[model samples]
Target: MSDQKTGGFIATAITSIAHFLTEARKQPALSEEAGYGASPNLPKPKPTLIPIMKIAPAVGWPEGKKPTPAKGFAVEAFASKLDHPRWVYELPNGDILVAESNGPARPPANWSFRWWAQDFVMARAGAGRPSADRITLLRDADGDGIAEIKLPFLENLHSPFGMALVGDQLYVANADALVRFPYVDGTTRIDAAPVKVCDLPSGRNHHWTKSLVANKDGSKLYVGVGSNSNVAEYGMEEEVNRAAILEIDRVTGVSRLFAGGLRNPVGVDWNPVSGELWTTVNERDEIGDDLVPDYMTSVKDGAFYGWPYCYFGQIVDERVRPPRPDLVAKSIKPDYALGSHTASLGLCFADDGRLHERFRGGVFIGQHGSWNRNPPSGYRVIFIPFTDGKPSGPPEEVLGDFRSTEGKALGRPVGVIIDKKGGLLVVDDVGDIVWRMRAV
Candidate 1:
């Protein structure tokens, strides 16, 4: 609910505490390893004082815009009129379900509690306003490339994100909770009221919510909770506020902490090869361009990636340092660092047997585009190739030219999934369109 900007006094205070903890935990290295003989791959230490970069708004695309040519794929419109579409899950019957996080009309500039309260009251009074959230079903009935929309399939949701279909049941992650609708073939209506699976903290506009994935056996579900404030606080209570991943039992609804210290893990997927969990995190903001790095990392149990303390793999954040000698020694660094402020969102492993063989087993990430840097970054989809369970190189642009030549953006991609026909389906919130990509 707090609309506090990043880098305010509260954020600075938290940063200071984190820095103190990191420094206090620094240990004296053995003589043999003290010299300039550290591993070559290790990142160099950064200075305490780093410059912060000012972020600019993105350029918007002209009306009726389309994607320019990319090397290996062609884009086709799948569906339109979607309101803030966040996630898309392909069902066994080749249908796709889309979840949208339509919320109270964009909060007023410099929002406050009083303004929000008034808005809520008006909304409840039926002030002739449109609904905030809903979900729908899309299908290509005749094997055509275009998808037809079936509206009102699921209605009256409190801004749901992260959807998955598991054998006769569809699970949705609503703001502050998880719900499931029983599946009935060829029908749009849910068989029964959604059964609550888990309760989470919601209502904050900045980090509303996103990304849910199930384990291979469907026994456990992983849900992402983004940070309440960027690098503001790290206390036990604050840590639980949308900064980690939650693992929940599918049947019992019991949930527990899966991983900690991710600023906003918007993109989460399971590595098909290793069965390990990987996430694309939107790192804390307000630091100069390139200070802290967003990452795609294999999340491990009880691992701490040092939000509000350290970032990327190892650079310590001085603002939030607070002398946690115990945590600094045990914090786990991320495996791969993407560029700062890419706003990475949804992630899925490429599994189709027909696309370029090079992309098989790689990861596809929807970079939602950056809002905290001078020149915006990540307005397209990129591929991270893996070989022998390791990254072969940096991400390559698989889809591009979603932004306008004048710096305006036409569409912002959030979620991605491989369709039944071995093509890729991408959800675009800005243009309210879902695009299907296949080899030409």
Candidate 2:
């Protein structure tokens, strides 16, 4: 049986590669910039029978090999040789928390083209590692940028991602639920039991990352829950409370939907100047790479941004059925577009942090890089300048060189945060290093 299974897998692989190559030839390798800004140049929709799959093969950074910093800037390893770190958080007392985690295993499914590709292709992109299931603490005791002390602060978590501290309690957004533990300032370790806050969508969990943020006074927590399947292909019945941000009361643990129609809202932050909630969303794939550009938008109460039914302001997606015209009419357009298939994930406002004057009064984004577009986009950190709470111009590259000309990734940056000293910190999951950036 084992021999037969292996043979079948190899056969399928050969056939899929042939198909992928043929399809790649048919599609035009257009510039990703065609899908940027308020009025994007969205060409005619070109839905494919099978999605294009392109990912840079993950290769760890060579010794002394780091990303290229922007002009007048420098990059250094804040902490190296970590497990799969995905998210970062800072405490009141200047302690840093890194969620060293990866996706949990799913059960084996029946043989299919898309299923096979997802299993094998994602792994090639350095996403096949087992979950670390713990949060590590790093303290810069001597006020230097490098963290001299590193230790596990919380353990045995079920694929934790987002975290926020409210008063004396620290909340963690796990894959399946939101939980909290008691935290004290200047504490290096947390051995207490976690209190359950509320449940988050988890079954089959195609997009399981649950990012979180807290409002002023710590009265409510906003959680980002991604869709179970792209474009509701798995049926809307399975999508209850998914693809939306949920607002939970910190004291009562009660939850409600704050906004909807976001396919995969990952990073949520409040704009310091506007005091408005904002998020970076990952749009649906398999349509043309130029369609459905991922976006960053301010969250409005009871507002819907189109998901499976429509995109980019009522440009309907014909893939879905039953045609809810009413919903399409109500779909709100996003504020800014961040290139198609870029996989924009992390969003951090330039609040009090002073990395440099160029980064001031702007928002920093970490694009996780693309897997469906040729000449794949977004493997670097970018800054978008804002004038009076609105995006003023195109993104300026802050860090690059994550992808090589030979199609290999040295690192894939994930969550980004600013430290106490105003230095910018980037978490590289593929390289397993936390890098700190400073103005030279």
Query: Against the true structure, whose lDDT is highest?
Result: 2
RMSD of 2: 1.9
Per-residue alpha-carbon lDDT of candidate 1 for residues 1-440, written as tens digits (9 for 90 to 100) = 35455325544554465445434545532221111111113334343232222222333335667665357678887888776677888878787888866544544563654334334323322221443467788878878778765666788787888887777788898876899988877776664788898787664444667568888889999998887666664344555646789888999998888887888998888787787899988886655444355678899987887776676545567667464545555678777766666777878887645566778888888877665343457788878888766667666778877776666667777798888787788888776778888887
Model 2 stretches with alpha carbons more than 4 Å out: 1-28, 108-113
What's every prediction's RMSD, in angstroms?
8.9, 1.9
Error of 1 at 424 (Å): 1.1
Give the residue spans of candidate 1 off by over 4 A. 1-64, 103-131, 203-205, 233-236
Worst 10 residues of 2 by lDDT: 107-116
The lDDT for every candidate, in the order shown, is 0.69, 0.87
Supply candidate 2's per-residue lDDT for 249: 92
lDDT of 2 at 215: 98
